[model samples]
Target: MFKTQPYPHQQMAFDLFKDKSYFALFTDMGTGKTKMLLDIAAYKYNKKEIDCMVILAPKQVVPNWTFIEIEKHLGIPHTVAQFRNPMKVKEKEQIFNLYLSKKDIGLRILTMNIDAARCKDGFKCLSNFLAKFRCFLVIDESTSIKNPSASVTKNLLKLSRKAWTKAISTGYPAPQSCLDYYSQMEFLREGLSGFKSFFFYKCFYAITKKIRVKQQTREDEDKPKGFGREVTIVTGFKNQDKLTDLLDSFALRIKKEECLELPEKIDIPQIIELTTEQKKVYVEVAKRCMSELAEDQEITVTSAITKIMKLHQVACGHVKLDNGDWIDLPNNRLETLKNIVEELPDEKIIIWAHYKKDIENIHKMLGESSVTFYGDTVDTQASLAAFHNDPKIRYIIINPKSGMSGLTLVESSLNIYYSYSYNLEHWLQSRDRTHRIGQKNNVRYILFYCKGTVEEKILSALREKKQLSDEILNNITNYVKEGMKV
Candidate 1:
C-alpha cells in the first residue's frame, strides 16, 4: 500500500488538478482534500515540474502541517520551514538560512502561517523563497483572503505572480455573497473571475448602497463639525447565476456524500487529560459531589445534580470560589480542543459547550474563524447569519439550549461536544441540528469527556436514555468506587 492511500474520490480529485497550473479545490472539508493536494505536489515534484512547494494555512494549524499531515500523506522527503511573524529574530534567521542552503532536499517545502503574511517580514520571506525556485503555492481555507483590503490579502496578491502555479481550497465558495469570490479567485490567477479589481467585481455582482449614519462622538458633539464615515452595505446581489457559471470554469466542486460511503452518524469520544492542579481540584470536587451518600448526609435530585454540575464546571477548567469569587483552575480542556481541531480536515465544524466560559474560550482559541451562538452573543441574529453564510467561519461554538430550537448548521458535517448538558432534550436537539435537511453528508459527533469525572456519568446517562437525576440516585453513594473508572 502507499504511505497514505487516497480514497477513490480523492484519487479522482488528484488527477484533475495534478496537471493544472492554477485551479481551485472546492471540495468540502474532511474529504481528504489536503492529501490529494500533497499527492499532486509529490507527483509533479518527481517529474521535475516544480522545485519547491509552499503551503499556507492558519497559525493554529501550522504545527499540524509541519508534523502530522506532511508525514502521513507525502512519501517524499522535504525540508520544511515556517515563515510566520511570532518567531524570534534568531529563529527567523535560522529558517531563512536553511531555505538558502544547498542541502540534498528533494523539495524545499515550507508551511507558513497565513496571518503572518500581513507583515512586511513574512511577505518578504516567502516572496524571496518563491523567487529562488520554481514553486507551487497552495492556499488552504482560501476564504481567509476574501477581504480585498486586508494586509495579508494585499501582501499575498503581490506575491502571487512569483509562484509558477497557484491553487486555493475551500468548501464554501460564496459564504457571504458572490462578491466575496472576487478576492479569493483573484489569488488563483489574474483575471480568473474576469474582473480587473474588487470594486469592479463588486459592481458586477452586488447592488451597493452607501449610507452615512449620524455620529455623536466627543469631537462631533462638542464641535458639530466632523461627519460620520459612509459605509457601503450590499443591499443585495445581482446576476448570481452568471457568477456561478463563471466559477464553474476553474472550480472543482466535491461534496462528501457524493464521493464517500459513510454512516448516518459516527460518534467518537475525545479523552482529555487534566493538569496537576486540575486533578487536585477535581479530587476535591469528587469528594463533595458524592458526600450526600454519607450516613448523615441527605441526598435529593436538586442537591445531587447541583453538586454534579459544579464538578462538571471544574472539569471545564473554571469553578466558583467561595466568597462569591470565581477561581479558574489549571485545565487542559482548551488545549485538548485545539489539538483536536488541528487533526480535523479543513472544513466547517460545529462545537457545542454547556458553559458560557467554555464557549468564550473556544471562540477565542479558534481565533477569527469562529463564531459563538449563545445568550450574550451580541446581535445574535446577525451572528447567526454569518454562521450560516460566511465561508471564513469554520467553527461555530454553540450553547445547546440557546441554539437548539430553530437553527440549521448543515453546512458542517462534524459536531463536537466540548462538554455535555444534563438536559436530555438539549443534548439530543443539538445532535439533530447538523443532521437535518440541507445536510448532504453523514454527521460525526465527537464528544470530549474527562474520564473519572462527572462528565463520564452524564455522557453515560444520556447515551442510555436515563434521567441523570435517577442515575445519580442509583450510584451517588458509590460514585468513587462503582463509577468513574477510567
Candidate 2:
C-alpha cells in the first residue's frame, strides 16, 4: 500500500484499465489526475514493466511537478528541462548528468513544457531523451496541442510513435468543437477515429459549406488570391453522440462534484517577508507615508485617501502609474502564494483580493483554472454558477468589496487573501462566502502581508474593527509626534 491513499474514483479508474497501450484521463482540475498517473507510473517502475516516463505540461506548471509533486508524491529522481530558449550550458550539463547518473534508479522521468515542442532544440532534446529507454509518455493539459496545424501538435504526434505506452489528460478535451478531439485521439491510437488525418476525420463528421474567402497578403491588408474557391467552412457538427461514444472508450472521465467528499474549512495566515528590492522600496514608501503626514497638511481628504491607497498598493506588489498603467514591483506575495498553492492538495480554492490588479495577476498565472469576479465581472451569476457547479474551475478570485455578500461558495475548502483592505464589513462578508451552510470542511484563509509596512497597520485596524480612515490619521499623527519614521 502506498503512503498517500487514492480517492475511491481514482482507485476505480486505475483498476478499471491497466493494459491499454495508450490512455487518456479526462478528469477535472483539482481531482488529482497527476497523482493517479504518477501512481500508475510508480507501479510500472516497481514491477520492472517500464524504465522511463516522460511528462510534459505548460511551462509555469512544470515546477509544480518537479519541485512539489514528484518530490512529495513519488520521490523519484527526475529532471525538468527548460526547452524555450537559448539553453544555458549549465542546464545542458545538468540534464546530461541526470541522464548519465541513472544507476540503480527505478525510472528516469524527464519533464518539459509543451510549448518547447515547437523549437528545433526542444524537438531534438525531447526526441533524444525518449529514445534511451522503454518510455511511457504523458502530456498534461493535452488540449494545448488540439490545433491540427500547430507545430507543437505535429511534433508531439511524431514523438508519440516513439513511446511504448502514451497518455494524455485534460479537463475539457473538446472545448469549442468536437473537432478538437481529432488530434488528441490521433495521438492516443493512430486510427482511433478510423481516420488518418484531421482533414479526413473532419470531413467524415462535419457539416461543411464550401466558400471562397480573401487571403491576407501582408500586415493590415487583405486581398483575394488568384484562386479563392478552395476553402471550406464548418457550419455545424454532425454525429456528436457517436463522437462522444468514441471518446468515452479510451478516456477515463470523472467529475469532482460526483466524487469528492471534502473536509472542513482551514485558515492559514501566509506571511511573506519582503524581498531585497521590496525592502528598499518599502523604506522609500514609508518615508513618503511620513512625508504625507508631515507636509501635506493642506491637501484635500480625497488626496489623503489616494495617497493611502497608493501606499497599500505598493505593499501588495504594484504601484499604479498616473498614466493609467501599473508598474510591477518586486514583491514576495505572488511567489509565496504560488508556492503555497503548489504544496497543498489539489482542491477548489477561492482567492480574495482588495486590489483589482492583484486579481488580474493571479488569474493570469493560473490561466483558465482561476476566474476573477469584481466590478468588471459582467455576468456574476453565471460566473458564480460555473465556479460552483464546474469542477474544472479550481479558483474564484473575488474583490471582496464586490463579491463578499449575496453568494455562497462553500465548494472551496481554502480561501486565500492575496491582499486585504481595512473594510471590516467586506472582510466579514468575504470570510462567510466559504463558511456558510452546506460547507462541511474548515475553510483555510491564507493572508499575505509585508512585515514592517503600512499593510500591518491596516490589518491591525481591521482586526480591531476600526475604520481605516480614522486609524490612518491617528497612526500618522502619533508617528510624527513620536519622531518615528516607520
lDDT of each: 0.76, 0.72
- What is the Å distance of residue 356 in model 2 from its true position? 12
Residue-wise C-alpha lDDT for candidate 1, range 1-486, written one tens digit per residue = 246877888788787888999888887655666787788888888888998999887554466577667887888877777666678897677676657788777777888878878877778788888898889998887877989999889889889988998888866655445777888888988788787888888888888777554453566554333256556766567888898788788778987678865449888988887777777777776665546345222344555677678778888898987785677778888887788788875788889998877887788889898888787887655666677788877788888877653355678889889987787656765776676545788789988988887788889888776657667655666664433332
RMSD to native, candidate 1: 16.8
After TM-score superposition, what is the CA distance of residue 157 in candidate 1 from its true location, in Å?
0.2
- TM-score to native of every candidate shown: 0.58, 0.55
lDDT by residue (1-486, candidate 2, tens digit) is: 343777888887777555667889987555677777887787777766777788888654565566567765674544444443566898777667656774665567777878888998888877887787778888887877889899999989898888878888866676446788888888877788778778889987899876544332344144323333246666677887888788778888887567875455455656677666666665676566668665432333344556666667877888877799988888778888788778865788888899888988998987887777887876665677678778888888888767653355777768888888666657765776666435787678776776656677677677666656656644554433222233
Superposed model 2: Cα runs more than 4 Å off = 75-84, 88-90, 212-230, 262-486
Q: Which prediction has the highest TM-score against the true structure?
A: 1
Error of 1 at 408 (Å): 22
Choose the strongest candidate by lDDT: 1
What lDDT score is found at residue 327 in candidate 2? 84
